[model samples]
Target chain A: MKKQRFDYGYILTLLISLVVALLIGAGILALTGHNPLVAYRALLGGAFSNARHIGDMLEYAMVLCLCGLACDIGSRVGIFNVGGEGQLLLGAIFAAQIGVWLKALSPWLAIPAAALGAMIVGGFYAWIPGVLKVKLKVNEVITTIMLNTVAVFLCQFLAKGPWKNTNKNIVAGTGNLPGSFWLKKLVPGSNLSTAIIAAAVITFLVWYILQKTSKGYEMRLTGDNPRFAKYAGMKTERIVLITMVISGMMCGLVGMFRVYGAEHIYKSTVSNEYYFEGLMVAMIAQYAPLPTIVISLIFAILKIGAMGMETAAGVPKQLYLIIQTIVIFCMAAETGIRAAIARNRERRAAKQDVKARKEGGNEHA
Target chain B: MHNNIWSTIFDPGTFSQMLRSATPVALAALGGLMTEHAGIMNIGMDGMILMGAFVAAVGSYFCASAAMGILAAMLFGILIGLFFALFTVKLKSDEFIIGCALNTFALGVTAFLSREIFGLSGTSGYAVPSLPNVTIPLIDRIPFVGKVLSGHSIFVYVTWLLVFLMWLFVYRTPMGLWIRASGESPETLRTVGKNPERMKWIASILCGVFCGLAGAHLSLGYLNGSFVEGMSASRGYIAFACVIFAAANPPRAYIAALMFGFFDALGLRLQSYVSSDLTGTIPYLITIIMMVYVVVSRQKRRERLAKQQLQRLEP
Candidate 1:
């Protein structure tokens, strides 16, 4: 019932968990015959060594931030949209197609059209599971996972079939979007683009909607207790459906960004589980919007830096994943750890109280 | 042409492949059923199976014995199950979040170890030990039935046995009742002087063991002694689907997995006529449809019962 604020205890727990995870990572590095310090140095250095690397990190962070926001919105409506991967793929392909079709148009008109197309496709894809969850009482998790596989296969089919690039060298992707549709790169030879500004604006809008709007209140209420929300005369089903669409649209926007800003084309490999990474970011942030952004940036650094660590210290990049998961595990167990610590303290206090009382009784006698 | 397509799709070899493909999923589904009945929604079985498959291959590679690989996988499975229980049961953490983290962890750990142990490709180039196909003496001589039923990996028969044994365990045993009660009503289970948490723990561990076996079967028996990165290929989730489709009934879960295998094999066979990519989506599409059908039929049944009750009240 209390507002979910990060009090001192929570911050302390998070810091302790992070330190414990790093220690575990170091132990793993030692076991694997890699120097932990060397690996850590490489990881940090790689993430920030040059302007290009920093730009790449920011580019990755933008996508991850959007994905995290998508997941966060779904969670706020008590809908777990694990199909963000699928939705993003569909969105990306649609955006690519739309981009090429509107190549004759001006950038202002074409870009927005492409973006809207992606959002429609993504939101529509998500709406299927939303409807099933709300109307049929079917589990959304299984359906979304199943749909993800279907979406991936569908994208592969489209990329290889009707949308296939005509160039012999381009093996399995659509033709590149026209130059007019491209988002201007902020750094030369880097993926970071003006799309980052749009992403930031969208993030701010999402934060406002979640924190300052009545619809957001309804969504949170529905997530916290659907039965209570229904009793209070809220349209819980509609809220869930709308939230699912919005979540999906965000995923779609990520796909459009990938096409218009970074890859400039639709490929089956446009995403390397970016949605899952974002989902992890959301989970680590405990489904909060602002924290999701921060975690996404941190995760992006780890992901990009892992490659450097691999090249420098001969440690596997997956070491970061292990560390991330360990941190998540620690966070998941925080409540238990706190409860155990409290119980120990209570027991010690009770023992001291009895001892002091006995001492006083002896003195009185 | 139609007859040829039918013949290709319905051949004895297809059924044999179906059984082979169903083995791992059936095994994992059986494991998933235990946790499902114990009131734990374990979406992490995929990770458990992935870990098991990797560990099994590694164990087989080093030990030169399939049995040892299976043993190693089972031991790892127990540890994973305990880890899962430590969070879900003991710590009262969100099971879904923990499950997701476990999946990610398993993916990372397996990938990391495989690259370290087997080199950059994350595959063992040399042949590791694999489970042998068992030929039943008399059954092997039978014409069509033997072709469909015999000379498969030993896990195929083991899975069939497990399906039957699990049915008996859940429906016929006292502990089985307690496990069900733990899911259905944990407070009632507590009132009967049994710890529901213990039942959940047992179920979780058993699920882990079964999933471990599923992984062993996948790498050692199904894939011919090779460890492929990400080879588990979401079968754990398919197994979860089977468990849901079967409503946690072991025999029914086996049937559900068989259906998946049948569609998978059909899709493979149809690849010559249809695009392989399109064919690949068939099983997943069918899974979604099946889930919808289950919900719809249940809803209809509930509506019919309500209508019947209303008529009786009017009379």
Candidate 2:
């Protein structure tokens, strides 16, 4: 087996894309009459001004990391789980319900029950598409997309109806979990909590599974070539199903963390397309676990800091989203761009050779 | 009670609403069918529609002409199509990833530009010109049928003509054959001296144009020139589903979209009895079931074919 070489090309492409996207963002800001420099400065300052801001960024990163991992694991198993948002929502609702129902129990029992409940709900939700894909050959992407809309509506209905908080101040959500169920905050007045440590541990486990385990090897092999894996006596179907469930469970865990560590309640707006952003992170990282974590942190910074830019520089927070999409577009075009460059160089070299040979022939004549 | 429920669900108003709602989906699906036949999965139709809607609203707001607004939307749609082609066709990037990115881009840019141009309210507030309703003279004189068919935005009639034209183009035109061949066998198309890539680009452009019309109808006709955030609302995806369910056939895709429209209309009517939140899921739930039904029937057909082959071999 060949040792894996450090990918300088990918990093270079990523850096170039980042710069191009930022420049485009600046151009957009200029068009909108905002001072780009001041906006960017405000963005960076907002993300890193104090311990509280840093903590908030980290908290966002934790949620993004788990969501990215969810996507990464699905891609690794040759499944595109576009329903991560749906699974996360389902997991969140379950976690909140468990938290509320188990209010009388000790934190140890309540937390575990809540976490398990979320995992089961998310995993079960994912398993349907997985089975459909493996058994019926139904496209998971379409099913997942449809399921996402259904899940959103279901969650909203529950929040607005049966489980709605009766408190006049609370509008569209379940009541907050008991204090005992809350995760210990890492920074006072910030959303950061002990959940970050759990997230880190989960990330490490995902890395270990993907890089160090035989099962992970089989999964990757199946993803790369199902026919070859099947000929080699591996049950590719089971691997796909298991990987999908695990991915869904990770998403569910993110939902649990958001409830216990951040939001402390289940609301219709519990997640603001965090899974979609996380999917983008996973895509940019090429579906790798470690890079997903790194990219998640960067995305978290952009998200958190965008608010500051909005307040301080008077630029819309949506500007960062535009920047992020531009970056993705550039990244997607990286291979094509490199290929074009190589083609141009080859054409030039051929022309040079022709010219040199013609000159040599003239001299001989 | 049953008779009243049936009467409510099957009213002329329901049919009119169905036609109105189905118009955009049908248009998008027809465009999606073009890309589907050319072997490109253009999931970014939603984003394209969103961009078109925003641009059309803005254009009408400024020019005070629905025609100019549609023209602007079509132009912008072509640009978006080229952008999509540059990535998916020229750059050979993953179509799914590019499509998702386009969606995110559309959502962000539209939201940002709407805020910047229209202020924080993000609405043109009835200042924009809407597409006028057209009453077919003879049809308007008819009874129940007239009520269902007449007095719609001009695009509704235009969509009906386009659907028929699209069917003719796909089944009767050489360019359609080339596009189909491009998706099915690019090498064969190349052997015949036709550029499959160019056909793909043409399909992308056509898809963009149709989606542009769909968006124009949505904002100007359906909603009275009002642009809402994410108003496309996965209708593009539903359109793509329509294309798949109909096997990329234009008329069939329109029928599939009509099915969605019918359910959506029914959901609206059912809102009286059921909660609006639950009713909203009806269309999406039906789409999922339709997709599953398609897959299951296909599987059964394959199984029957295999059984037939086994019997022939034994004999």
Candidate 3:
């Protein structure tokens, strides 16, 4: 069988699907008595209108991109590490706990230490499912999901009990960590912090590792075919373990930044959408590291724009989620579109061959 | 150890509470087990349950009839199942992504619709009727087993009946064999002229009906006809775990669901003595620990077998 060419047919299908989704969205707007055009304009304007809004979008993009990279690695290796949320939460909890506990250390050391600590915890958390899957034939999907529930409960337990913000002056959350360990603000008016740079750097590094390293090649091979890799004498189980660990660590790093840059405390009020959004980003990019960054940023822009849409056009702010879901659905359905494209190409090839045979017959006559 | 604690465990009142608590999850697990048996991984059982609850509440509110509410819930459940099947089977979508999409979509759409239809209260069920508990005549007066088995909603009894039904369906039926064959050897089944997709669809629709009933039980029986955001919580996933632990056996899955229900009840009781926060974590913590233990022991067993095989090869 010939390889399917990356062609325009699939892109056309994606475009068509997106248009249909947008039309459905417009119908929803009309039913709600909101002007679709106005909402669309406001959403677009809000996403890019001001520097601060752009910064928020960037902030959202940065964390999303980082998590997307982690997810991309897992997906490429066929691991489907759906435990990104759990890993992120565990990382955040660890970072906050360490930051709050270690009062003696200087800010620089403490911050890095907290981040590193979270990475380790997150990595270990992921490794459990990976090990279970490899050694015992337990399904990772089930394990990761169970682990996510565990992580949510753990976070809830810690925030309300041991780490209880104690001040009682605010809503339930953990007590504030040292102020000095907070990420340095990158822009004067915006919440943009040095963490964005850190996240971007991490994304780049992931791209490099996947494209340049021998281990990355082996990991990809393991994802593509474990039996084949085993026949080639690769330690497939170890690769699975390591791949999950790295995926978990990346998620932890995203959590580390969220704690340090945006929230500045371990709060249970963290968004539940991050994990799904990260998965969406990775999947939309077809599990490519670099493209993940772009897709995540685009999603961030939509989120920021959603505020404008709500305020000016009277559209609900949750419109961003609908748009995100539509985009992902279209992207995920690309496989079927590609198959159609292949069939089309095959038919076209057969027609051309028939014409060539007819021309050869004419020449013989 | 104390008299009160002992009473809580062995008393008829406690047993009744446990059965009532276990009913919804057991019902949902029965549905999930059917899907798993047919080789379709369904993570959207929670979404189906949530929709069922909402629809049941809406139907009961307008019609003021419990039967109407149940019928409405089943219809909604079947529709959602079709929605899931469309993506997974027809569109060739990844089951995991589609499941996640369905979950998020249900969350948003239900919340959005509840606001529009029921007003902006974030929940509704004002003046809605609830399921009346059915007490067995003579059995209600009997001791432990009577309390454990007698007083429950019609749905609860139905759930218990389903355990037997599912067992029979899985073990004693030709269709059950086909489902197992589809999961284990779809190609073989296809060669014998069976449509595996059709089996999966049947499994999905059945799962949907059960999950819908689970939701109905939650809103109508447990919460007294109220629908709230994410009210199903992680019960669907917990039921899914029960399916795993029970190895998809109906009777075993029922037992596992009961174990979860027991912990849920214990957590509720503990809430009064300890911080409500710590108490709330109990169910989730138990689930995790249970899964981890199950996974670890299974691994150890495999390792031991591998070791034994190696030792035999050494001769």
Candidate 4:
């Protein structure tokens, strides 16, 4: 019953937050001497203007979908994994290692090897912090973030030192994977790859795990009330560790797909925007599997469109980042609303008690 | 240019580098300590630092005064603090989420402003009038210690003083007692006719002030008065780790901050011989090790206590 009421509140909060955020975006554009309408139109047009643009946007959305699912796995189990960027990079490096080193293998063998490699490495790397959290009671958030820093540097090291491609003559990015390792592009001349199918499959799998399985129930219980779950004989520690590993594995898929489906080479300089975008997607979707795709698509449109706005309309791409932050702030503010409602109830109850005392006094008189 | 990475460990330059690098983190760590004791964690210190750096750079650049830059940074800190308190304290928002949002938002707005105003991601290397490095009288005559400590921006000295003050503030003062009570038991604070929420807001504001100063030091003092897109480089996160390392103790946190700074300096020094990228991971890796040690030791202590209780019961 409370969840139903909160559903309405969440929608109201989202709508209000979006409106305020848009207004702020417009104000910022104006302050920078750009026409907000033209810029927005350019942005929309750029994201969906051509078949190719739409495909690009879809590709980004697909990648974000997997990342969001990764986030959802941890969040639903009451863990905050801010190491999505690190995990993704670790996956990329693993995929790159297989794709580049094992270049002689057939397409069938090479592709699966790359995918499996990414998943295992990403999951295993994240499992360290999971063990720390479960056995030693170390806070996962700090550990994950620290690991992210390490992972980022590790990727950079590989690119610059051991994996340097003399052919590319660049120090920061690995060489492109063999064509056989690449995901077959869906739309010719677009980043849209077989990754979209992977996104769909993963979505279904996440839904199944979260809804149709006893494990899912246990995980949700752990998230909702860990003490209650423990009292009910659930091993909350094992659940947390498994959930983190699974979440990290899902993030690994994002890196693998990006390597095979999107960027052929891992660019260390690429902004970590997608990591946070995934987090935001999962948050806005309330950790549900399906809604994450929709949220991811919306973000992809803004991000891809912002490039167009930058070129044709003289607006910076940072505008999308600003909007993302606003949405996150609004969503986070929901907790504040929850607290306020409780306070109001307490005040009302106190008032009723006073009224009852007064009625009793009058009756005695 | 020694091939040995270990040799640089004893170099006086390395120590000075650590001192310079740790100054900002130590300040930010102390700030975070305030919020931690008040039962809040300002994970958004990175954002506050970025905003402070940008505003300080802008202030110093336009007004041509380092003093103005510091002042501007502090003012903006107060503003950000109020913004944080309003959302986290008054509205009771999820502090971590709000903090992450604030940091991201700060990154965006500052990047946008910098691009719009200066048409660059970082400053254009103009001569930015910064706080002058000072050479202490007798200290300058000493050897390695003098070289390490004598010459630095005034903010470096201020940080040491602030650390001492914070130690006193969190431990000796009545307000310090209240802050601890707020974190430990807000219900107790309420029973005593005080608002724990209000205390958190105050802590948040103080955090902002310290974070702001940290940023000013980075942009105006350390970076020679230049605002860079990511000059903070997760120092805020490092500061967060330092808070955990010291468990909210100001002096110990200061030491923790220096430890990271030392590793960071070591990474830079090792770059001539080893892969710099690999070396750069040292600070983060050490931080993780420190966290693991702290937890492991605590767990061991708990196990020992449990064993002692079991023995007593048996007897």
Best candidate (score: DockQ): 4
DockQ metric, candidate 3: 0.32
lDDT of 1 at A116: 96
Put down candidate 1 lDDT per residue, B7-66, tens digits, no spaces: 999888889988998899999999999999999999999999999999999999899898
lDDT of 4 by residue, B81-109 (tens): 88898898889777877887888888888
lDDT of 3 by residue, A112-200 (tens): 89989989999998998888778766678767877787788778878877777868875656778787888987765666889988887
Q: What TM-score does candidate 4 reach?
A: 0.95
lDDT of each: 0.89, 0.89, 0.79, 0.84
Worst 10 residues of 1 chain B by lDDT: B118-127
RMSD per model, one decimal: 4.6, 4.2, 5.4, 3.1
Model 1 Cα lDDT, one tens digit per residue, A64-111: 999999999999989999999999999999999888888789999999
Per-residue accuracy of model 2 over A20-115 as CA lDDT, tens digit each: 999999999999998999999999988999989899999999888899988988888799998999999999998999888888899999999999
TM-score of chain A of 4: 0.92
Question: Where is model 1 more than 4 Å wrong at Cα?
Answer: A1-6, A339-365, B308-315
Give lDDT tens digits, candidate 2, residues B1-315.
899899999899899889998999999998899999999988899999999999999898899898899998999888888888888888888898998889889989998998888877767555888988989999877888899999999988998899999999998999999999999999899889899999999899988988888998888999988898888998998998898889899999989999999999998998888878899998888888888888899889999999999999996
The regions of model 2 sitting more than 4 angstroms off are A1-5, A340-365, B124-126, B305-315
lDDT of 4 at B243: 92
TM-score of chain A of 1: 0.91
Q: Which wins on DockQ, candidate 1 or candidate 2? A: 2
lDDT of 4 by residue, A224-329 (tens): 9999999999999899999999888888878888888878877763436578778877777777776687788888998889877888876778888899888877
